[model samples]
Target chain A: MVVEVRLFASFREGRFKEKELELPEGSSLGDLLAQLEIAQKDAKITIVNGSAVSAEHKLSDHDVIAIFPPIAGG
Target chain B: MAGYAGTFLRINLSTGQIDKESLDLELAAKFIGGRGLASYFLTQEVDPDVEPLDPANKLIVATGPLTGSRAPTGGRYMVVTKSPLSGTIASSNSGGFWGAELKRAGYDFIIIEGKSDKPCYIHINDDTVEIRDAGKYWGKLVGETTDLLLEDTGDPKARVLTIGPAGEKLSLLAAIMNDKYRAAGRSGVGAVMGSKNLKAIVARGTGKLKPAREDECKSVVKNALKKIRENDVTSKGLPTYGTSVLVNVINESGIYPTNNFQESYFPTADKTSGETLAEKYLVRNVACFACPIACGRYSKVGEVEGEGPEYETIWSYGASCGVDDLEAIIKANNWCNEYGLDTISAGATIACAMELCQKGLVDPDEIDGPALEFGSGEAIVEWTRKMGESEGFGAKLALGSARLAEQYGAPELSMSVKKLELPAYDVRGIQGHGLQSATSNRGGCHVRGYLIAPEIIGLPEKLDPLSLEGKAVWVKIFQDLTAVIDSLGLCLFTSFALGADDYRDMFNAIAGQDLTTESLLQAGDRIWNLERMFNLNAGVGPEQDKLPRRLLAEPISSGPCKGHVHRLPELLPEYYKERGWDEKGLPTEEKLAQLEIA
Candidate 1:
């Protein structure tokens, strides 16, 4: 299965802005973060298919994932 | 009186009389300071029905109790007056060194009343005040006016706050530029200043801010500093990328309005995102007076360099106009600053005009400059300059979106609430932020109550953006708390790390007050109701508490948030109930009595 992942702000430093990753069918969001070498604590906002979700949430093929550090402004 | 300079200047521009008066401590305590106190003065002195550009409408520049104090990010001031744009009471806030300098000059605020027969500028040097001739500087761009004013004063250290040609011509979208780039940039406050024939204000102060409880102030300030340093949003995110960091965040969330909100997503948002700006154009990060966050961005695009292209500015000129040319957006941002125009309103207005042209309501032959076409970076940059100068058809664009759309007989095409243009966020997908924008005293504003913080950013805690539960309560609390922060002379960014109790402690220590957290919020609630009352008296009533027709009736055409429309009607009643107002959204007498408004 393949998932599209996007990164923003400082989280993109050294890591790619966006990429597609191959993972097992039963992979969780946490599994994708680990594969990307991102600590669970640093991923303050995690979204799957545009809905915010916890790391333990299940992911499937073609799911769009985005992760960001704690960021805000008006 | 320790936190306050305890004095203010009342200048009658009509008669050239400058009277020095002591601040009323009792009233100051009731209203807090800055926006709250300034609104109190405006409501009392100016008739709500008066034309906003009339000399009868006074421009009150006010600093808060914590302004120039040891509190982190305390350098903020408000330009309060009747708004020509929305016809509601306008209080536009700006962060920069000028507010702190004004406080240091032994004055808490300046009230300029009446109209001057000749162009003039106010010069304040500690105790000395003069209304100097400003004929030579009239009609100049903001940067030139700032430099010319500094030369005339012979004090380069003096801070300059002036209006550019947009204000001089009374463009409804004009902004008051201070420190050359920082702006009290909404509600057409600059037009009010221009209508009074006042061009600029220069201040260079040598006095010091005296905190009432010096020992308590030190400890409280230290605690604030520590929390700010520890917070992720304040200490890292903002300082690292500035507000433009949100471009990707909002775009990914699918609520980023594009092409005047004809769509809710921009595919190439990353091209204009903060990361790209830092990589390509950023010169350095700039900080306001005593600011630790330093979220201000100074960027260069070829030979033109200036502060910002902030999150809203980028969205307005980048995504909102359907233009992904980052360099062109930077140039347009510079044009806005130089011409003293609100970048959000300017870009959003152009976006509105593009839609009108697309629908054939606006004739292409009439444009005469750039084609009113989406994705044209040339249109965005050139239209912005023309709008500021009010040149040719740009004069109609200068009237802002609401007027422009109505003139073309497609009033619904204008993406605005009241007469003010909405910002970057597409409220159709964010319910709470939508409700806040609908009911904002100043129309279509985000900063009044940025529910986007919890809804999208997950600051403090995250709320499901699609959910409708507890949103009214959230909106009320956020709006109230924001009023308190604005009144205290502090930046809203501080609220991400500091809570209501932190603000309470700082106020008590600095102003020598015994305010509990509840009473402190109650004061904010009072300010909120007071503004509502002023708006009501101005004939901008509950009927105006609505989002644009497109937003309320149309769903976002595509994106992750597809088929979602703002649930404003469902939430407005609950909001009114939370605000202790009647069903018509008017404040009840009992609520006013509880808040102790005279």
Candidate 2:
């Protein structure tokens, strides 16, 4: 299965605004993170469409994933 | 005194008498510091029935223990006074080096009472305090006054808070500008300063604020800074774009309040977004006294290079007024900062006038021949200067939105609560935000509650923004947590990444007292109730805790949430119940007892 990922702000600076990645039928969030070419390991991730899921939770096809960096402004 | 200066300076401007009082440990333990301490002093000293602009009214400047320390974002202070705008208790917080400097000057707070016979500035050099004549700086802009004070004091690092011509003219929406751009900018605190004939306050302190247990506190501070640097939002998004980054994100979510809440989104939002500002105007990044994030941006709007407007300023001046010209918005921001005015209130007031003009309720002659049309960048800049200087149309605008609408025989059209104008967020689309705004102690304000964390940004947790269900509970929790953070003098922005437990940890480390999460929240609840009590005693009640008729009756004409109206009536009951208040919005005796306020 393939899923779409969206990144914002500095993450976009790294040309990671959108990505198409292949995954197993039921790959966990941890598995997807391990497979992605994201340079930073401490990046915060948010699933924009799906429920708040942990790294161990499995993902489905067509799930929109949104990732962010730390918050700074008030 | 692990985290205190051990003294409070009291200045009676009328007699030009200054005295120092020792900090009371019992009050410190009960009220904490900053907003909490300021409220305590206001309640204890100032009479509730006195006019906010009268000599009897008092202005309190307070600093928390964590302020001026190595704590991340510790450079914060609050100005508490009887607000001329709302005629109720008002506490306006500011982020700058001034707060930290006060703490370093061997004083936890400074309380000014009795109007001065003439214009003067308070000068405090560690262990020494005097009220000096400020005749030269009487009508100067905020930036100019700050420069003159620093030069006269011969201390480049001297922290200053000064009012501009707006305050000198006693404009109802005047504010005190500190550290150049950071402001205690709500509810006419600057007017109170003006009433006291205070033009500025300059302080220079060489004393260090060392913690009792330096090693432990240093470790805690280091870890917190490291955590902030690692946080994705603080490390990259905020530092890179500042708060203007929210423009695109909010606009994308279809909750950007445009054209005086007539619409939920702005079409030209991208033109005024952080990305656009970074590409065009951004010159450098600035930070408050000890802030490590450096989220403050200094930008060049045309030839002027200074502190740029933040997210709220952009929305209030740009999108809210239907103008998308970033440079014009920047210019308006500069005018407000220089003139010592609250940008949120000033912009909102102008937006209200523009809406009146669109409805044919206000004549062009009333606005000095300008059409006062939405999206007119030139008009915004022009009227803003007029308002700051209290000239012509600006004189009417200086009366604020509520008064302007009332004068036009359309008070309901004013998008304000208790006379104070609303902030950037449109409550029509964000339900919880509406509840918070309506119930704010100082009238329509976002800082009092800020339900946007869950409803819009989805920080810590996510919730449906359109839903009214559970909104009452959400608003209560956010309000309590925010009260705790504000009283402790911690930057409320940290709540974006840190939770209640994280705050509790820091509070315990700084005060050298063990504080459980429950106790901390209770402290916040106590502070909230105390503020409410002050307001209620000052004559604001259930009638004041309501949104304008337009928000409750009129639906959005277009957008994703088109035809949506605020459910304030339906939510009010639940909100009161959650807050342990009655229908009159008074804290129940039982609730007060639980918080130990009784």
Backbone clashes, each candidate? 0, 9
Give the C-alpha lDDT of model 1. Answer: 0.93
Considering just the first chain, candidate 2 attains a TM-score of 0.70
lDDT of 1 by residue, B558-597 (tens): 9889999988899999999999999999999999999998
Candidate 1: deviation at residue B596, Å? Answer: 1.0
- Alpha-carbon deviation at B453 in model 2, angstroms: 1.1
CA lDDT, every model vs. true structure:
0.93, 0.83
lDDT of 2 by residue, B290-329 (tens): 7877778899976767887898889889889999999999
- DockQ for each candidate? 0.84, 0.23
What stretches of model 1 exceed 4 Å from their correct place?
none
Interface RMSD of each: 0.8, 4.2
N/CA/C clash count, model 2: 9
